[model samples]
Target: MSGNQGSFSLFQEILADQTQEINDLRQYITNQEQQLNTMKERLMRIRIAVLMNESVLRPFFRVPPRQRDPSYYPVIDMDLEAIEWMQANNIGGQQNAIRRFEAIYGMNLRKCKILVRTAPEEIVEAMNQRAELHYSPCYRRSLRDNSKIKRMKLICSEIIKLWEDCQSAAYPSDQIMVKRSNLERLLNEFWDGQGKKTEWFGKRKVNLSGNKVV
Candidate 1:
């Protein structure tokens, strides 16, 4: 009977020791969870601070407002093709063509002249495609986001959509022209309807006269 009692007491002690160990483990786990949460909060605060600093510093780092490409100015020889097209379409002179091209594609006078003078049909086509995509409605209206990388990705996606539209068209030239009109319409609507909200994209301002990438 005494041996039985001793065994029972030993077992009770073992069980108590295990329960205490478990309680200690639970307490350690709770402290670790609290520490992890605190670290996460600190990380979030650091992220917010970094973003705030970027927002404050962005204007200073912005690319200076676009200027005309120096080499292409003066437009020495008139682009015969542009002149011919203008005559056919009753569009008038070189100045008028420049204005029309700028209004439609946001191209500068010199760039338009260069496009008109480009010898290779394929090169001209490629240039037009690039301009159309860069000035697409979706691109112009794109807003800034928290991630600059994601913002660039979104812009590229919009440009791809423009490319797809051009590729899928029955007549790529006509589709490109239509897209140009759409670009003008969308830009006008953004500027007129949204007030300064359109400036957030900065592309319109950055590429005001030509193809300078911001």
Candidate 2:
């Protein structure tokens, strides 16, 4: 129809899709883990029996036993310290997944790092091991593909809740941790690129009324 109508329709579709996706991810984050673990346990029991029979059970009656693989989702029993730390850093229990992945593979998941999954500091001296074999890194581009700018705001708000929940959480502590300038930079990063460039916006300001020049 009209240009404004088309824009509205596109916005509506995006909102609907995002809401559904968030709900699905929240459920998957909460559930499906148990299903994967159960499947893996059952598979292990069947695997032993299949190996003993040596397979070749003469085609007709012998069908390959169904085997389920464990989902790559991080299965972890986080330490109390890690739980505290994760809750300290990330709210809604999402950081646990990140910490578990870090514990196993030694990855750095800070925002600036762009979410690289690397191994922990357990360097072994093995001559036979290939240099690359001992160390592997994977990058998930999901960091830059954040669902929306609002999510970042929500994360900061939730983190503030956690700090408030803590015994020693206070303004001075965070003052040392994050500078005011840094938060200003964070705002700039999110608000930027959407509006016109501010680099040379007021470069040519004219002094019409006063004798002001810079």
Top candidate (lDDT): 1
Model 2 steric clash pairs: 105-118, 105-119, 106-118, 106-119, 106-120
Clashing pairs in 1: none
Error of 2 at 163 (Å): 3.7
Off by over 4 Å in 1: 55-214
Error of 1 at 32 (Å): 1.3
The local distance difference test score of model 1 is: 0.44
> How many clashes (backbone N, Cα, C below 3 Å) per candidate?
0, 5
Residues 112-148 of candidate 1: C-alpha lDDT, one tens digit per residue: 5654564234334434444434433333434642243
TM-score of each: 0.29, 0.19
lDDT of 1 at 8: 100
lDDT of 2 by residue, 17-45 (tens): 99999999989976888887676555433
Cα misplacement distance, residue 194 of candidate 1 (Å):
38
Regions of candidate 2 where Cα sits further than 4 Å from its true position: 1-151, 167-172, 175-182, 197-214
